[model samples]
Target: MPRVVFLLVPRVHLLDVAGPAQVFSTADDLGHPYTLTYVAEEPEVATVQGLVLRTETAWPSLAPDDLIVVPGWRGPTRPASAGTLRRLRDHHASGGTVAGVCAGADALGRAGLLDGRRCTTHHTVQDELARLHPRAEVVKDALYVEDDRIVTSAGVAGGIDAALHLVAARHGPRAAGEAARAMLVHMHRDGTAEQVSPLLRWRSHVDETVHRLQDLIETRFAERLPLRLLAEATGCSERTVTRLFSRATGLTPLAYQTALRLERAGHLLERGATAETAARAVGFEDARALRRLRARPGRTMHSKEASWTQAHP
Candidate 1:
């Protein structure tokens, strides 16, 4: 049985910690043999949504092959201390798997473990991470990514998906399926699946302009989206499009357009659409351009055969 350690920080999100815990702990019902524990920088941590939990171990006493799961941190903009970074780096160097869910990727990035590795975080912070870590291949279209020994998830619910993926990787597909079935969730969304694939769900952004522009961009993904034209379509100035787009989506107009194109291309690919067909459908001139866009490491295009196989096999 693999030992799993959930690493917590001050003001961590409860769901980020609880979602995976509930799934792993379900094994208790089956009388399976696995050890799961929560550890913090200190002995106790408070969740952002007003829950407090106590830890059984501190960071310095971890063992190898013990999966260290990092929950989302309180804020993305805060700096991680050198001591914390050293511990995380050393833990991974000693052959342990470090997994981060949602903003937890922020903590891994701070530990310098994500440098030059493919990784992801909540979509709202993709551009910020890109600006901060140019050496890292920061993916915007993935729910989770596993590169070398590091794993990362996109946002809230993504934590669950990533956790399930870890279980699958450690045990097998059936184990992951059982875990998800036990929890009544989907198993094995390709690691490459977009963190923000459901564009419609982006309405929850704090800014109305941001939400409106996101809707407009997604609504017209197939159309040629000139900045001036998009501004005109939204009844806002081009400057407003440039500014609000970044604030709400953490991406500029061009980046947003690219994201939509990639998403549509993925949808087409999953339906077994040919590269040529998928490319044309999503406004890419040809399959070559679509390939260029999707050729980034740590992402894959699932064929229609693969999609149906996973669904029905």
Candidate 2:
């Protein structure tokens, strides 16, 4: 098994570590050969999340396939020792993968890995990174950037995307998708930036009854949804349930289910899955039906849910 070493710095953001850790861990659960370890400048490092992380100060022997991940910390700055910087640069030069999540890119820049390389950091720090490392090509607002052996990412949960992209690139898209599903994260497409698919987020409203109904449909959407059962779950008659659902979501129950299936089918198609397979997976009787639904006027984002990022926030 190839070993994955996490270089822990002071005042680390727990999720930056947790996100990629969880990604590779989940990939391991899928039976990938990966061994995770941690190294720190000290025996123990403090985290921004009010936790102390115990790590090995002694570096381990790593092969060409081995990896080192630098997770972002709370403060804009971290005290990376001379030894840490040497390991990062040396390992990458020798064919190992080195990656940074969010502001962890700063560490890579300091290690000279970002010099004349395409990279990115948290959006808040991209300009500073570019200014400090004049030779580094820092892509602003990128979900993540990969050049040669180095990978850098944007802020917060963008680490998840970066890690998953690494998994997809190294293993295969199917393996990465499985890992994502195991982690319960929406695996967004690579390149540019993406949030939780607006299709999924659009369903997030405060109507408990509608939420329950939608939740049920979400799980069994590929199967026939019994309107009576949904109505019963909503504590109302079928007609009343339809009215209530429309009032809450501005769509009939069937319309919402169709939308979910269509969106899912579109994603599958984007991933190179055949239309027939996508249709079957998303509950259409056949590819022809899915094709018709795709042709529906205003089938795509049109509701207040359209400007989802701004609409909700």
Candidate 3:
């Protein structure tokens, strides 16, 4: 069994912290043994949602062989303290897999481990990260990216996918699938899937607000969703809604909604809706309008073809 320790700091994103813990915890149910532990700078930490997480171990006692995981810190504007950076560097030097999720990637970037390495963070933080760390190749097109042992995921729920990839790499695809089954979430996605694109963010988090917005958009995608309308509907200020949505889910409300439409449109096409009907069903005024908004970089043919094969067989 591989010993996996999740490291969190004060105000860590809850989903990012919890998602992988569940993935590794359920591994034993699938008969793929792996021990999961929560470690922190201190013996306890507070989550962004006001939950207190009691750490099972402290940083200094972490073993070199243990997989060290870092969930995203709460704020990007605040720099990681030098002491935290030092410990992270030490963990990397000790030859363990050091993984960072969302803003945690910023910590790795600040520690100089990401220099010349391909990495990613929450898409909204891209500009700040590029400005801070020029040497790092900050990728924007992956759910999670792994460069050797240093792995980083794009924002919140992407941490789950990235963690499962590591689980798959270390154990096997079956183990990863079993982990996802435990969560009732999809299995590991191909690395080529859009990472930071608007399409990806709509599917990013399992939070209440995120899911509320997701359901709203899925049900009302054909309707134009301006920022003000979303804010009004959610009872938040437009700016607050946008920022929180971006921070929690890595996308602006409108973009996330559009992505939802595209995804539904995809399903409609897969169900044999003509392009025009698919567009209409998903709220597009015209099929050509759907084409302009389909930023996902491929035809809907792959899904349709798979559906066709299933039916033919």
Clashes of each: 1, 0, 1
For model 1, the superposed segments whose C-alpha errors exceed 4 Å read 27-32, 57-61, 76-80, 197-313
The TM-scores, one per candidate, come to: 0.64, 0.65, 0.63
Q: Which rank order by lDDT, best down to worst?
A: 2, 1, 3
Q: List the pairs of residues colliding in candidate 3.
A: 222-283
* Per-residue alpha-carbon lDDT of candidate 3 for residues 186-242, written as tens digits (9 for 90 to 100): 446655456544444346566666666766766676776666877787887888776
lDDT for position 163 in model 1? 80
lDDT of 2 at 128: 83
Candidate 1 lDDT over 115-169, as tens digits, reads 9999998888888777877778998868899999899888678888888787777
lDDT of 2: 0.80
Stretches > 4 Å off in candidate 3: 60-65, 76-80, 195-313
Write the residue-wise lDDT of candidate 2 on 1-313 in tens digits: 9888999998988999988899899999898878999999789988899999999999999898998999988765554988789999999999999999877888888899999899988867789889988999988667889999899888578888888888888899888899988988865556464334435645757778888888888887777776788987878899888777778878766767777777778778867899899988887656887786677664543334332221111
Candidate 2 accuracy as TM-score: 0.65
Which pairs clash (backbone N, Cα, C closer than 3 Å) in model 1? 141-194
Q: What is each predicted model's overall lDDT from 0 to 1?
A: 0.73, 0.80, 0.72
